[model samples]
Target chain A: MEYRRSLLEVRDLHVEVEGKEVIRGLDLVLHRGEKLALMGPNGSGKSSLSMALMGHPGYKIKRGAIVLDGNDITGLSPDRRAKVGLFLAMQNPVVVQGLSVTNFLRAILKAKRGEEVPIREFREMLVKAMGLLEMERSFAARYVNDGFSGGEKKKLELLQMTLLNPKVAVVDEIDSGLDVDALKIVAEGINRVASEESAFLLITHYRRILDYIRPDGVAVLMEGRIVASGGPELINQIDRQGYDWLAVKTA
Target chain B: MNVPTPPLELAQEPEELKNIRRKAWNVYTQAPFPDRASTLWRFSSPEAFWIIPENISSMLERGKITYKLEAPNGLLLSDLQQAVSDESVPVGALVGPEFGKFEALNLALWERGAYLRIPERAKIDQPVVLRKHVSGEGLVLDRSLIHVAREASLTIVEVLEGELTGNGNGYLNAVKEVLVEEGAALTLVEIDLTRGTTRAFVTARHSIGSNAELKWVLARFGEGVLKANLGACLSGQGAKSEISGAVFGFGQGKSDIHTFHDHVEKRTFSNIVLRVVLQDRARSAYTGLIRIGTNASYSEAFQENQNLLLSGDVRAESIPELEILTDEVQCKHGVTVGPVEEELLFYLMSRGVPREDAVRLLVAGFLEPVLGHIPGDFREPLDGRVAHSIKPATEVENVL
Candidate 1:
């Protein structure tokens, strides 16, 4: 595929973690302001693609190109990738103690942007984000996702995403552990972030989330490769027919 | 940070340390300094022998000691000296031929309070917490006293934290006494996390009144040779006591916890559980005794100790003893010592977690029975300290 002025472009990317290849020459492009949904079954390497792009330690780039904007980020560390406008909403975030959620977001924002926001501005941003996610104000004072329920943890990730606005966001399986009300609030939060200037690659196994947050494009990933790409209607087809449709079409 | 300290040279507490110093030295000299013939030093490393009382007062100059009160009532928080003056308290420092090692303590005991009196029908949910911190080096002598009124409930949490790392020798001699009035409930939780060439001596005793209750938890971690003794006396009818402890000893550290619970009252109850995890060349020992007197009829008492040995060289010994001078007491005792189950480690490794990661989590969760018992406020710091204290199963590369 020809690369346009896309925010993120993964071209023929093959990745391996600890000598085991998980992503084989996968190719996909997330344009600026576009919402691309990557749907795949378990072990289909949906998370690997995001982890590889975010530069997780275990994943090795066997062959391919991961060009963010115009700079190649194939060799960058996860933190560095994060600094350069790349964000990954982890499936299961690491629990860190002695660090409050508010503190973590501020540090992450400062590190990623290379500058710290004033206390008032930070608090204002926090107030707004909490309101948008319907989160209790007291939640900010607690440790980062420490002893949090499944719904609370998912909401926390969305809270981080809302505060630190990135050029490209790769949300991996955000819909897995959310309740109906929480899913709606999270979708509203994600929809507010999605615009013409910011690109989002939302990876989900279920299609129920597609109802709340409309996608500009949809892609099917099977056997570590994108098998199909089409307009918004593809989500409905998958929802009605399931992954079995993708299997038949791919075959 | 490197301000010059007054060359206080800890040499046996000096004359300024006064009476307590004189008695501790006398006991130190007669104790023979844990040598070859002694059973106490049989499993402990010999290098720990150099940790003498030589210059203990000097510790006041090198380390930082800051304390925070547990909460609203402020009660007795840190400053060990203030604890003695708050009430006329006894530190059990009597010079005697039978217990000659504590001769110095009698001289140092502050005679303000005789007992912790909990007024009858006083209901309390707030816990009394004390934090003791030390940095740099030297010798530290700490003490505290607690009294509960009748029907009053209280919890005491003591956290001893050490910061920075250097070559140094330090000794901590801390003693605490608790007096429970009739119809009172007293709970005590102690966390001792100190590393380096340090030696810690902790002595504590609890006295229970009629229909009063006592609960005590002692969790010891980090790298050091620690001698801990906490005991309780049920001196009145219908008094109750429950004791439990967990110790994680690794590297060249040594830990020995000896508890003596006396059931001297009628219809009293008692229970005890002690667990130890030994790694590297470290050594751990748990000795406990439950003595039921002749008049203590219709009473219940139990004691048990378990040990997990990570390596062959790391040895663990347990002795659970019972003295029943009465025929109408319900009592039992048991002891277990062994290595970590290979099947548990294999089960964890089968998942995505690496062997080191798996082992770390296993050891952590293995001790969770005790860790989980701790209240939430101090849980994180305690876990972090334990994670660091248990000899970090995984070594990090100094890439930075």
Candidate 2:
């Protein structure tokens, strides 16, 4: 008997933006229901990798294969990628006026299922999600990300991640601009949504978000390539020793 | 051309600007120049006043002018020519009956059950509308006078659809009045459709009562030319007024928007946003102004005009001004003319919205702020019409 498993295999991915090569060839893999933390310094292409995987038009994938659920999605659209259970909670979500928060959520759900859910059932699920995120009902009436505080926006993104229940989520700097209290809420939101059924690739510059996520695998990215791969304690070591492990490179 | 007057009830005396009418008409004559100037004109092309022949009676034919309601028995569109029954025989015995042409036009177009005499003191419902369709190169005009009684509410939608179905040019001259009694509220949505050389002049006058809410929304479409005018007076204290507009055109088409908000009493408020998109050598101009009078205090007025140039050949001009007599006020004005944000375009395209859908979404987002001014009843048509106006922007990139 074979056990069901989930995996995201990025074999030699090259990403470009505005014709400039940004993320040079890189390779990494996350197994079913596993968590991978991608840490990098500023401008090291951590966010670009995540964006390219989500099919952001801003970044072009010149080469490489992104296989999720046994299918190569190297050239898929962002929405198409999202439909296949790929999610990206951007550090700064676009503030779209006149488009209510409930609207985007409903649209994503419909796009994924190709059908709308019963209003009552959807509302019930939404209520539970909001309650867990400690969000007020009035927030639902407002436009998507419009005039919301940075922390509020993160919570809302987390709520969406939970509701959509995607197979893979690449979060870019989820802990930025959050207070200690807000950070705790956001981390908890991520924890609540993450399950044994899905895998997550958490990208960040700081080690704070890892406090709650507890990545099953840790990868350090330097100059567009993965420099090291280890377990959770490697985060504590990196935070204290700082990538001196780069000089004693092993092929 | 003569018709009877429906006795206008007057409480406050009219302050005649008789001496200034010449200046107004003279200013109206200097046009075709690029940069829109003057707060009174508000981002409007000064050259637009003469886009159509001033002498329209000589060119129009009765046979070509006809209208019908899509939803039979719901509303019938009668030829406004039939309402004026006497005199004013231009095309001498038109395709329809002889009456006040404006009346006949309204009657023919809205002849069905929607005679909805608005009750004073009622809350305005969503989807407020008054739609009029014109299918000829003849002189098309619509005139409506409504009074929302003290504490009452009302909404009106007027749509000008040109179906000359030929290269023949059409002209539309329209005037509408909204009399909001003390504490009354009113929202009016007006649409101007110009296709194949169609040209039109539309003027609207609104009087907002004390503590009343008035939202004025206008949509300018078609590859034709249009000059839309809106003026409002906040007569009662605490009255608030909103004026919003959008004009989308291509292929040598031109559109102009002129708006004026007059704050007469204390605590009067005004806000406006006019969005324009031009392509294929088309041009759009906006001229707007906010006037705060001496007696007005605590007045707040905001104005912004934004134009998206899709191509280098497309030209967009904007002028926004503010005149405040009382120093105690919060007033600001902004004008922006540029192409769509490249980041936004790339973002949407990355999502597989298609480059065209991406442009459409960006343009639609620019117009989203105006949806608030539209009453619920007119939302569907308003949204539909706006979505169609989001033309590709690259053809008008050089427009500025």
Candidate 3:
């Protein structure tokens, strides 16, 4: 028998934000084209784990090694890590005043593509992508998420995900504040970006999002560690028995 | 050109004009220069403008003025000497000596000026450009008098450039007075991109008539010290004014801007937005006031000043004040002075944008409220100047 190494491997992760430990000794493995649903009760450090993997400044890695595609990316800056193909769909998108959506998207695309796109082509691509998210054409003219509603913010993050086309994406609570229609649209958008060449880690607390986009694996994150991992049946069991069963089993 | 001495008297000038200049000079000489103790001059270095009357006169003489008219039909454009001599143009009614000390000095010794008069009910759709250049180390006093008659409309653009020779410094003091008659409209754009260690002082006073409208846009990207005093008086019913300005200060430059919106009549409206970006050791300060008089009922006034500091050593101060004596009027002022938020920076960085470029984007966005308000023709040039001003701070060879 032969074993295949995972595309992303988190080994003995211990993360802290502002000198307080949040994610303690967590380990997870994800393969290319795999959708891993990270589920847990509130305060289980699911978001912290995702942020730690992305090398957020506020989340200090006390002890961890995040290997991406056989390269150690634990010490890279957030921007460098992004250039290396890591993307995080933040739960609450930041409202950047004064920067238009078009300019911001063009800049990020330019930085990633390593060349400036012609104005006409850039505008065309932006309009097309905005259309996919059902956003108004005028949304590109407004400041970056300056006055967007909660669902609109989520759609914006998803819009960037499709445009940037990262190799590995960690979507943190992408469906938390979204309505049912927005949730389906966002899930469809996520599915549009997820291809055979990329991997996804969907960090969520609710089970509704899983209904739209089927997950290949389900992992229960309890007390800062992956206490259980299984097929889609695990989601049903957790839905029926709640996370208490997993907590008691871990204890 | 040799530096001229103070108390310059033109023998051929009219007695009334001569008497006005003499009175202005007397007032300018007797009034002491503004000191730091004065609340208005606290953020600026008062000694930066300390000079004798002869030096001020000399600086005013070195500035050259050119008047370019895109629509020469229904407008009268002339130099100060000719405009004052012509009986048809009422120069005295446009500018007066009671404005301030800077106005006094400028009105008394201005060597070069442009007077523009638009005929009643005529609309000059094209922009009238006024190019004023100061060469060598001297004083420059340039005056602009604009009169838009009843139901008329005009657009004016003023560009001030200074090129200092050798190691000498130049001082440019300018005054612009605009009168928008009943049902008239006026749009004025002022761009200051002077180089060297020259000092610039611009005082602009506008009077809006009944049912008239005024829009003023200012861009400041000079290297030295800049002091701008802009005021608008909504003296007639249904008058409206919108003033917007963007300033980018880099290196060791300092910029101080003061704006006032005086609503004196019923149903008047005014809005002011000013944006300032400071990098390196530069500093900028903005003081805005909105005054609603007793009879200015149903008036609406809004003032906003936002400042962005790119470096730790840079400083930005915003002060917004309001005095309302009338009821049923709406007036609000907002001031924000801070550096770029860490969350915004991190959000951009997370999307593969380098730190330096992220900062640049944030700074550019900080000025958009004012930059977007600029007329389309002037927006690109002003945007380019702002980008050039912050180039040094944003240049990065490599980011880890």
- Find the candidate with the highest lDDT and give its number: 3
**TM-score, each model?**
0.63, 0.74, 0.93
Cα lDDT tens digits, model 1, B105-151, are 32242221222334456665776666777566654555555767778
Model 1 regions lying over 4 Å from their true place? A1-4, A17-19, A94-99, A113-121, A245-251, B1-170, B183-198, B208-227, B230-400
For residue B186, give model 1's deviation from the true position in Å: 5.9
Cα lDDT, all candidates: 0.69, 0.68, 0.81
Q: What is the DockQ of candidate 2?
A: 0.23
Looking at every candidate separately, what fraction of the true A–B Cα contacts under 8 Å does it contain? 0.00, 0.22, 0.81
Candidate 2's residue-wise lDDT over A1-251, tens digit each?
45746578899999988998888889988777788999977877898898888776678889998998777888776666766777888877777656677755665555566687778888898899999999999988888788999999898878878877878888889999999898998888888778888888999888998987789889998878888889988899889977656635733
Q: For candidate 2, lDDT tens digit of each residue in B74-108?
A: 23333333322222212111111122222223222
Winner on lDDT (2 vs 3): 3
lDDT of candidate 1 at residue A86, scale 0 to 100: 77
RMSD of each: 9.9, 8.1, 3.2
lDDT of 3 by residue, B1-400 (tens): 2334445467766778777787677657767677776546778775665556556644555555455545456455677677676655554454566556667877677656787877799877778776766666666677888888899987887776656543445666778888899999988888776776667777888999999999998888756778878899999999999998888888787898889899999999999988888877888988888999999999999998888777777788888889999899998888888777777887998999987778878877887877776567767766776656665444222233
Q: How big is the positional error of residue B225 in model 3, measured in Å on the Cα after superposition?
A: 0.2
Relative to the true structure, candidate 2 has a C-alpha RMSD (angstroms) of 8.1
Question: How would you encode candidate 1's per-residue C-alpha lDDT over A30-101 as one tens digit per residue?
Answer: 898889999988888998888788766557788998988888988765555665677777777755543567
